[model samples]
Target: MEITHHNKTLSLNSPVVMGILNVTPDSFSDGGQFQQQAHALEHAMQMLADGATILDVGGESTRPGAVDVTQQDEIDRVVPIIKAIRERSDCWISIDTSKAAVMRAAVEAGANIINDVRALREPGALEAAATLQVPVCIMHMQGQPRTMQSAPDYENITQEVAQFLSQRIDACIDAGIVRQNIILDPGYGFGKTLSHNYQLLAQLEAFHEFGLPILAGMSRKSMIYKMLDKTPQDILGGSIACATLAAAKGAQIIRVHDVKETADALKVVAMAVRENHELGE
Candidate 1:
């Protein structure tokens, strides 16, 4: 499958890597590392070179307990970087935000996808994405970011998530957002306990019933670090493992910090899938 935006098209026949580019100072991992315009551009180019098919640029920090920035601040942080990357390359660019204004500005500055963690539940978000006409990734989060992790209780993790996404998908279609332009993300670490996160991953294929592409973003997240008793910086292996599993389960995109490693792991996944098909034949 392919998603088209303006003059860019992203193929989803196999799993693709989406390099994380957080331009905020307080993100859980690699925060403040690419806050500068030049550094962010450099990292964007490097990620593209490292086999990333898309660059997910974020201005606000969505980590649990993270403070929200003003809309203008978010636009300022992300637009220039998007423009710079667009000027240098025509690779797919995804703007990670839920604000309607930021979404408009990012698309104007050359973003191809709207990767909203709020699932377009924010005021005006659905309308903006509908008007922008780019691919939208709606994630399932139990609560708001500041308090999502406080008490993330759920009856059945996967079922609840799928239900929420189903409602959102209906809402998006109602708002005139085409079904083909939608993506699903089961919001790992957003409001999930460690076990809750794993439950979602294990049953991820259940979401395929929706027939939309799935975007798995468990890179350096607390789900991996906390389970392994390691820091975010030390969870590369865990991150890649999760990416591999997600790809094997038919995830279309893997959002991650370590682009090269994730890309390499996806290569193995592709090989194994081919071998399995051959054996079946």
Candidate 2:
């Protein structure tokens, strides 16, 4: 499968890593360090060197219970990094934002995708994406970040997520965005409890029912640490384990933090899966 954006098409036969670049002071993990242009740009370069096909740049912290940020602040945080990255390298950039204003500004600054957890439900979000003409990764979250985890429950994990994504895709189509410029993310930890998160991952291939690319944002998420009874800082093994599962189950993109490690592990999985198909008896 491929995601077409900004006149460019990216192949997703093997799972690809999207390095996380948070330019906020409270991104749940690795914040404050990349808040400055020099620091952020340097970090982005390192991730690209580590083999990330896409760099997701986010300004505000979407950590559970995190505070909301103004549109201008998000614009201020992401545009310069997008501009600076465009100046140095040609890595595709995805603006991890929910606000319409930031979506417009970041794309103007050379971003190729809008990774919105709200799934473009915000006012003017669909319109902004329509006008910008870039791929939009719509992630499904049952509730807002601050309150999503309080009592998260789903009657059927796979079906519920598929339904939500189907609605979002229909909404995007109605709003004038082309089908080629669309991707779907199950939003692993956004509003899901531990069981729900795993269930979705176990059944992630079912989302191929939508016929769009599936993005697994399972890099050091709470779902991993919670299962291991550890913190996000100490869950690399779990993260790799889940990333491997996501890739085997047909995920096209794995949004992650441990870039080099994830890239290496996925390289092996891609080769093994290809070999399995080739030896068809």
Candidate 3:
């Protein structure tokens, strides 16, 4: 399958790596590191060279207990970086924002995908995404980012998540967002407990019943760090392991911070799948 937007296309024949480029001052990982426009562009180029097929640029931090930024501030933070990256390379660029204004600005600046953790539930989000006409990744978050992790209770994690995503899919279609342009993300750390996160990962393939591409973004998240009793910077191995597991389970997009390492891990997964297919035949 392929996602096309404004003369750009990304093939989902195999799992692809999406490098995280957070230009915010306070993301969970790599925040202040890329706040400068030049630095952000440099990191974007490096990720592309590291085998990332997409660069997900986020101007605001959605980390637990994170404060929200004004829509204009978000646009100011990301537009120049997006424009600079577009001027440099044509790799798939995903604007990771939940506001309608940011979505419009980023796409106007040059973003091919709208990766909203709110799943387009934010007031003008649905309308903006429908008008943008680019691929939209609707993630399932139980609550707002500030308090999502406080008390994430779920009787049946997979079922509930599936139900939420199903409803969101219907909502997107109703909003004039084409079905083929919709993508699914289970929102690994957005609002899930540690157990809930793993359960979702183990049963991620269940989401495929919707017939849309899945974007797994467990990279350097609490799901890995908290489980390993390590910090984000110390969980590269764990992150890659999770990415491999997600890809093996049929996730088409693996969003990650360490693009090179995740890319290398995906290569091994690809090889194993090829070998298995050949032997079975």
Candidate 4:
């Protein structure tokens, strides 16, 4: 399958790695590291070299209990970086934001995808996404970022997530978004408990019923650290394991911090899966 964004088409015959670039001061991981123009640009280049098919640029920290930034502040934080990357390469760029203004500005600057954690529920977001005509990744978040994780509960985590995303898909179609342009994320670490996250991951393939590409983002998240009792910086192995599992389970895009490592791990998974298919044939 492929996602067509304007003049670009991203193929999903093989899984793609999306590098995380947080141009913010307080993202959960890698915050305050790429806020500067030079630092962010250099990191973007390195990620490309390390096999990142897409760079996910974000200005706000959506970590639990994080405060929201002003629209202009977010735009200022990400647009310049997006422009710089656009000038350097035509690689796919996914702007990770829920604000309509920021989404519009990022695409104007160079983003090809809108990866909203809120699934475009913010005011004007659905309209902006439809008008932009880029692939939109709608994630399932149970509550607002500031308090999503305080008390996450569900009768059936996987079923609930699927239902939520299904509703969002209809909303997108109603807002004039092309059906094929929609993607789904189960929203790992967003208001989900440890069991809930793992349950969703294990049952990820269930989402394929919608026939949309799944984007799995489990990089350096609390889902790893909280389980292993390690810091974010020390969870590379865990993160890679999650990425590998996601790819093996048919995820189209793996959003990660360790791009090179995840890319290498995915190479092995792809080859094995390919070999298995060949044998079956």
Candidate 5:
């Protein structure tokens, strides 16, 4: 399937890698690496060269218990980088934010997508997205990052997430966002316990019942590292494993840190799936 945004459509019939660029000081991983514009641009170029189809930029760290940064701080960190990237590359740039002001500024700075873990539920978020008319990714997080992991719960993880996403879609529609410009993410690590995270991944395809493109972001999170008794710095292998599973389950976009490995793994999966299709002919 293809995800069309800002008059551009990304054909994700095969799995695609979306490299993560965090321009903050406290993201779960790769935090300080991109705070400087020069360094951030260089790393972004490297991700593109390594075969990233999209680059997701986040100014705020959404890791549980992370303190909130002011709107101006968030804008200052992302806009310049977005402007710089847009001038140099044609790759799809998604702003990872929950704030409406950030969405408006990032789009003005040339972002093509809004990847909000809050799913645009924040005040003015829907209005801002509608006004900008860019593609939006509505992700399911159980609660605010500060307290999301406090006491997560679910009767049926898959149905609950799918239902949550469905409601968000309707909310966006109510705010005047177009169907083709929307995508859904089940929020793999935002507020989920280990079991909850794995449950969501195992039943990922159920989200397709909503008929929207699914983006999976399981890159080096606690879900994998903690389960393996490893640290985030040592989760590349886990990341690839998760990426492969997500691809096999019909995830259109994989948000990740190690772009080359993720890209190569996805290539193998995509080739196999494509070959199977051709043989069926």
Candidate 6:
């Protein structure tokens, strides 16, 4: 399968790694490291060299209990970095934000994808995404970031997530966004308990019924750290393992902080899948 957006097509024959570039000072991982234009561009280049197919640039931190950043500040934080990356490489760039204005500005700068945590539910966001004509990833967050994790209760986690994503997909389509341009993320840690997170991961393949690409962002989340009793700095192994499992289970995009490691692990998954296909043939 392939994802087409802005006259560019990315093949999903092999799971692609989306390197995380948080240009914010308070992201759960790698925060405050690349807020500078020079530092952000340098790190983005390194991720491309390490086999990241997409560079996801986020100015706001969506970590649990995070507050919102002003729209202009977010635009300022990301546009320069997006422009610098565009000037340097043709690799896919994704603007990770929920604000409509930022989405428009980022695509104007060079972003090929709109990775929204709010799934374009923010005011004017759906319209902005439809007009941008780029592939948009709609994530399923049960509650707003500030209070999502406080009390995440769901009768049936997987079904509810799937239902939420389905409704968002319909909303996007109804807003003139092309169906093929839609991508789905289960929003792994947003508003989900540890058990809820694992349940979603285990049943992630169920989302394939939607016939859209799945973007898994399980890297360095509480699901990994809490389960392993490790801190964010020490969860690389767990993160990579989740990436590999997601790839093997048919995820098309793996969003990760450790691009090189996750890319390497997906390589192994790709090889195994390829061999299996050849044998079946």
lDDT of each: 0.95, 0.91, 0.94, 0.95, 0.92, 0.93
What number of backbone clashes does candidate 6 have, counting pairs of residues 3 or more apart or in separate chains? 0
- Taking the tens digit of each residue's C-alpha lDDT, what string does model 2 give over 1-281? 78787567889888899999999999886879899899999889999999899999999988889999999988999999999999998778999999999999998889999999999999999999988889999999988989988898889988988999999999999989988679999999988999999899888889998888889998888898878999888999899999999998989889999999999989999999999999995
> Residue 235, candidate 1: how far off, in angstroms?
0.8
Pairs that collide, model 2: none
State the weakest 10-residue window (summed lDDT) of model 2.
Answer: 1-10
Task: Write one digit per residue (lDDT tens) for candidate 3, span 35-94.
Answer: 998889999999999999999999999999999899899999999999999998988999
Task: Kindly list the per-residue Cα lDDT of model 6 for residues 209-244, writing each as its tens digit.
Answer: 999999999999989999999898899999998898
Model 1 whole-model lDDT (C-alpha atoms): 0.95
**Under the 3 Å rule for N, CA and C atoms, how many clashes does model 4 have?**
0
- Candidate 1 regions off by >4 Å? none
Instruction: For each of the candidates, give the backbone clash count.
Output: 0, 0, 0, 0, 0, 0
TM-score of each: 0.98, 0.98, 0.98, 0.99, 0.98, 0.98
TM for candidate 3 is: 0.98
Residue 161 error, candidate 6, Å: 0.5
Against the true structure, candidate 2 has what lDDT? 0.91
Give the C-alpha miss distance for residue 142 in model 6, angstroms: 1.0
* C-alpha lDDT of residue 265 in model 3: 91
**Where does candidate 3 clash, by residue pair?**
none
Native-to-model Cα distance after best TM-score fit, residue 222 in candidate 6, in Å: 0.8
Question: RMSD in Å for candidate 3, one decimal?
Answer: 0.9
Please estimate how well model 4 matches the true structure, expressed as its whole-model Cα lDDT. 0.95
Pairwise lDDT winner, candidates 2 and 4: 4
